[model samples]
Target: MKKRLAIALMIGAGLLIKAQVGINMSAPQAILHVDGQKNTAPAVPASYYDDVVVTSLGNMGVGTKSPKTRLDMRSDDRQNAIGIGGTAQTASAAKAGALRYNSGTQDLSYSNGTVWTALAHKAPNDFVDAENPSKQSFTSGTQTIVTNWTKKTDVNGSFNAATGIFVASKTGVYIVSFTFSLASGTIANDSRYETLIQTNSASSATNKVFKCVGSYPGTNGLSNRVAGNCSGIFNLTQGDNITVNLNQALGTSKTLDADATLTSLSIFGL
Candidate 1:
């Protein structure tokens, strides 16, 4: 080891005169160059594969001979990742621009020096709207779970239009909302109606995310069309499901309805 070190020093001294040293190659392309593969015939390496270099400006390049940043790395057609361990320590303004894995939030956090911001990706969002719309019938004197929804715009494929259930893909805070327009001439002046938004977490009969109720406005002359809209913010777990329901009173039967203007459902992460 001593002999090898002495020889290396002597060789380094010879190269020091030119202020450039190279390993595994006769010509040095940078201040410090180490070619792991020693396949130096191609002139320009492909993204510096099997190569490391420190430029004269003190920029280090991994897998590339030309590094634009302080520490540049490239691996052509290969996966590259940095594994960071979670820490309990808090980040402060002094630590601005620092990065760490936050176990509590299970997210990558960046420090602005005073506070840590979770670098979460874009949240999921979905929307469904009714055009012209259709009517669904239900027996009076009973609460029914509304289903058989066909109009849908589920970008994430997280909603089942036929089943009228939206399943959450991740655990996060979400904003949920739905609007339903009851068919005109179907509701009576003496009748009452209800609309509900239920979730998988609330299994009990009385539990629900939102409930809308209304009574017929007045006798005869006025428009009998009724519409109900409900919205709620919830913290939901992954795979949780949400569905809607309806009920009407004082009529032979009640029909769930919607018009082009007042029917839609939307769910989005915050």
Candidate 2:
């Protein structure tokens, strides 16, 4: 009788050890379940439902047993399907269809399988210089305006003060504009003073992007001031140089206004 009691006690202990545990639930589907849920504990590495799986690497997949990518989420709903926190990087690198945050620029950008573009509606790279040499002179033909613009509001450090050129650091469409007031000595009927937004990569005579002409009507006095502005959008590559040029028809010197608002160059990436 004692031997029979010992065997029964052993059987009871084995059954208790193999029993399923549940919390806030009467029946549990997994070995340990909380409120009929699976893998609620941090100690549990993974969980699965049919082919859908969550892996130890924190990758979750639907309709797949093994996730090939970081997050292989699949859904039929096109609009309300997926959301990502987005990877953060110090600088932009080539990535395909990736949404990421640029820490350097403090902006959000996305890759379109080829190039990375700023996610914001407007351009991320922008600069404006309004302080510089009070006056610049132009002789007869084309002459680069060597204005010493000291104050720079370059957001991306793309503008070079030494060269007086805005070098593109990112490839995109850029809108470049310059406004300057011109004062010439004597006014002739056909005298023309042209302000041009020129790029070094193209021929200025035919491939100039923007030009503004200040024509002397012969009625205006010698001290008359004329404001000229040139603005245009152009597709630019990285390291491309942009500068302002002035061309005068007659052999006379023209002065660019010293006023900050009157003479300035601005560039923005699109």
TM-score of each: 0.51, 0.50
Candidate 2 residue pairs in backbone clash = none
Encode model 2's per-residue lDDT on 78-124: one tens digit a residue.
Answer: 22244444564433354566777654345667787666687865446
lDDT of each: 0.70, 0.62
lDDT of 2 at 118: 78
lDDT of 1 by residue, 1-270 (tens): 999999999999988766879899888789999888787544555635777899988899877788888987764534346678766566773388888875434578888878878896654454444322446777776777666666646666877766678877666777877777766664456677777777785233344457778776566434466677778887776667787777767476645565544667777765
Q: Which ten residues in a row have the lowest lDDT in candidate 2?
A: 42-51
Best-performing candidate as measured by lDDT: 1
The best candidate in terms of TM-score: 1
